[model samples]
Target: MSESVIPRPSGAQQGRRFSLGPALLFCPGSRPDRFSKAAERSDAVIVDLEDAVVPGEKEQARQNVVQALNWEEPGLDPATTLVRVNTASSGELDADLDALAGTELGHLVVPKCESVEELDALAERLPGVGIIPQIETPRGVLEAERLAHHEAVVALFWGTEDLIAGLGGVTARRPNGTPRGVIGHIRHTVLLTAAACGIPAIDTICGALADSQRLAVESEDAAAEGFIAKACVHPNQVATVRRAYTPEDADVEWAKALIAAFEQEAGLAMDEGRHAEPTVVGAFSFRDEMIDAPVVLQAQRVLSRYDATRQR
Candidate 1:
């Protein structure tokens, strides 16, 4: 993507909170058994409708997803099962919404979300489904704030390929191997928009399914840039995505110390090595803004999970 093509927000603002698991399992309808098994191990399961199902077999994929939702899989929370529907204007949109309407599934992942109006229409149809809108075009990125704030919208995921193509971005690889120009700008815009709206920000699917090393790097890169979770094209990418989202030991320790420090003095003294200035802790540095929320919570979340696991 090119810098000129990707539009930036007019003013400086805070970022958003992203909720991602170690891995989100994706089933595109090609491999049912693989998809089912992946769902068992994945942090969340996403049944895909776009880019996965053949044109002629789209209905079959929809039926498959609905059937899967009706199945009672042990240990699988229906709330964590997300259906990735086709674009709001696609032929399959109504069918997708109909299938999702009465189900126990809590999330609907809608692609090519170009405006809040589209969301309004979908929300009218579904009434109460949590919308995870995929911003995959220039118009979509520009309207991100509105989409993010839409009552139906709970999260926004960036789609690199579609947005890049929309912006006429070159496919050529940079010297470091990452795409240069327009494509990178689209990503930056997606991050900025999601941050401004205070919703979860997710990264697009990594195109390189065979290169595990590259996949790991890409996942980590998204994490560093404030993307909480990433879309997976294959089960192989789930573990990599999960590990990328997890906090390291150092992070967990820091979060624990911060929480402990604040609890001890009601926000007075942090650990000697960690706190250069006692006053910083007194101000409650960690809780002031959205940009810092993810880092702080990630650490806290890790420790909590560890504690919970140990008890069981």
Candidate 2:
């Protein structure tokens, strides 16, 4: 997609910032009773109004969400609570928006998002709401860059099962449970596109509820690849996702030591009356590895993740 096709946020929109914690748990909108529990269990709760609810229950689901928003006690936090609306083509988005209008909810997860025009229309109806576009189809993956740049988009999430289903594939994973090659490609494409647009990317949910070990491995891979968060289908998966995203104790110490060493080296350079370049001026050895600007930046990222997890 060309840069011109991507619309920039307005000045007011540009000033707004949205972020979610590392673990986001999904709760069916039809099951309002579980909303509070889901919120308590995960860092953020996504009340799913789309696939989670059958067509017959969609209206009831919408009403349930509205009722939950109106509750005085144990109300959903506008910051951490998100609603996953149906696709624009589903014929239910209009009703979804109508139900959500004038509510305190400020965030939405738009499923099957494949175009900027769709987002533009949604933003027009619900002004000031942040959107996390869920890319699942081939067109969505190809147009991810354009979708990521939309002003309403606060983050990007890709769905593996839907993508595979859309492509007429039998499964997204191999018999051994590792993701198929196409799934990996789509995941990386969405991740890189979101990163390029300076927004967070939410990893797909782990459907295998009983396979905690696989979920941990996948969550670790997502974190290693720079995904800010992972979506969970069940409450039990939340802690595993959080643990994978959080930096290890050894990693935190190593990052701190590396940063200190770089600062010391830079100090010595300045004391010698040498000017430091925008990047690191020279390379040095750290823990038997050649340390450079990139290495220092990686260390800084580790510390940043560590700090974010601590604050959460």
Give model 2's TM-score versus the native structure: 0.86
Best by lDDT: 2
| TM agreement with the true structure for every prediction | 0.78, 0.86
lDDT of 2 by residue, 3-66 (tens): 5654646422442355476899999998988989999999899999999999999999998888
For model 1, the run of ten residues with the poorest summed lDDT:
8-17
- Model 1: per-residue Cα lDDT over 45-164, one tens digit each: 787887777778888776666666777332235667777888745687888778777667767788888887888888788765677888888888788888887766777777777776
Candidates in order have lDDT scores of 0.67, 0.84
Task: Report the CA-based lDDT of candidate 2 relative to the real structure.
Answer: 0.84
